[model samples]
Target: MTTYICDDPVDRRAGLDAATAAAARGELVVMPTDTVYGIGADAFNSAAVRALLAAKGRGPDMPVPVLVGSWNTIDGLVVSVPPVARKLIEAFWPGGLSLVVEHAPSLSWDLGDAKGTVMLRMPLHPVALDLLRAVGPMAVSSANRSGQPPALTSSDATAQLGDQVSVYLDGGTAPIGIASTVLDVTGPVPRVLRQGAVALDALREVAGEVIGAGQPDGA
Candidate 1:
């Protein structure tokens, strides 16, 4: 496995080239995100996405999230983005917030039991965004085994995933303290699934009355 410590003025082109090349070949690439390091593979490649799940010791029951470079990328994958969702996306995207929305019927990609929904995030990290723009959407999950604590750095991820990954793009320490907050935006009202970096109070302020984590939509 090859590792690139991108902390000290690394070349953006080099990082993007290496990451996109590896991802295109159905290989795993570990890279830093706004919250934590993520293990990434082409979202549209089932084999690559399956391989990513295998390396992380993940099963097909839990769906993996996709990270995009911009709002248009999300629009392509999902059938619709509600007006409320649009407000949240406008305010918190390119930051830590993952929205679960109904996938476009025409799409054929599989990432575990995505069912009819897809989790979408647009990270604020530069390296991750560069890779996403160059490689397109990626099936990105926290770079650790399914139940393990998320990796904060490339080294931490390497220690866990090892050579199962083809490349590692190290961008020093992570800036965010927690993973992106996950919310289900597939229904009439947005509902919180997991509260993390983007806290509930902040979400409530921006989104008005969002359903709390682990509770019924109107609870």
Candidate 2:
């Protein structure tokens, strides 16, 4: 178990290298994101993903989300990007917005109980972006035990996760210190599954008429 202080350029580069190597080995890593710290694994590694779930004491019923380095990464993951999804991505990607879309049937990895859909996001943190760009898509979830408040700092993550995570990239406290707004885009209209950093009003501005999960379609 290693924790790298990433405020130093030298330490940051080294931490990224260690994290990339760890993911390649199918090991779990804790890294910073725009909203909070996340524990991540190589998205293609089922065993690693399972380990990530175990580390958090979470069940498959709550599937992990995937974090991408770029906007274009989502094209290959989902069956097809809806026009509204593109609009949302254009407006709030690299920030705090997660879209749940139907993943391509041909893909091999498993995130558990997601049914046929996957939640994807592109975080706006430099350390996270650099690591994701190097490691490809990662199965990431909030870095804390299930039902606990999300970790806003690497130390908070470490306190909960301990040696379960192979690499801990301490990128200081999370900038937003809140969870991302999660939206399900598989429906005819975008629906807000969980509201967080991004407001529903802002989502409406970009996609027009967004609905909460409780509301009926077209409401």
Candidate 3:
């Protein structure tokens, strides 16, 4: 297991390189995102995804979210991006907003019992973006054990994940220090699944009339 300091350009490049290689090899890599540190694996590698869940003591029920490198990356992942979803992406992507959409049926990988849907996000962190661009989509979850606090620093991630992760890129503390707001866009109107960094009012401003999880449709 190795943890590389990413503040230095040389070290950052080395860390990203190692992370990319690790992901390609179906190994888990801990990296910092805009919200928090995440332990990531190749999204297309089922074994690696399973190992990531095992490492975190998480179950298949709470499937991992996929991180993308850029805005256009979402185009190929989902069956179709709703106009409302596009508005949300334009308003809050590369930040702390995640969207749940029906994925392409032909996708070969499994992210547990996703029910044909996938949660995707593009983090605003430079190191995370670089790694994602190199490695493609990754199945990622917060860097900590299930039911444990989220890891804010690379050291915190290492202490929790230990040897389970192959490479740890210490990209300092998370910029937002909170999770992203998750919106499910699979229905007629978008609904809020989890409220975090992005506020409901902010989302409403862009998408308009987004309902919460328990609220009836069109309420």
User: Which regions in candidate 3 have their CA more than 4 angstroms from the true location?
Assistant: none
| By TM-score: ranked, best first | 2, 3, 1
Which ten contiguous residues of candidate 3 have the minimum total lDDT? 210-219
Question: lDDT of each structure?
Answer: 0.88, 0.95, 0.94
How would you encode candidate 3's per-residue C-alpha lDDT over 33-151 as one tens digit per residue?
99999999999999999999999997899989999999999999988899999999998988999999999999999899999999999999999999999999999999999989999
52-102, model 2: which lDDT tens digit per residue? 999999889999999999999999999999999999999999899999999
Supply the global lDDT for candidate 2: 0.95
Best candidate per lDDT, number?
2
Rank list by lDDT: 2, 3, 1
Q: RMSDs, each prediction?
A: 1.3, 0.8, 0.9
Q: Estimate each model's TM-score.
A: 0.96, 0.98, 0.98
Enumerate residue pairs that collide in model 2. none
TM-score of 3: 0.98
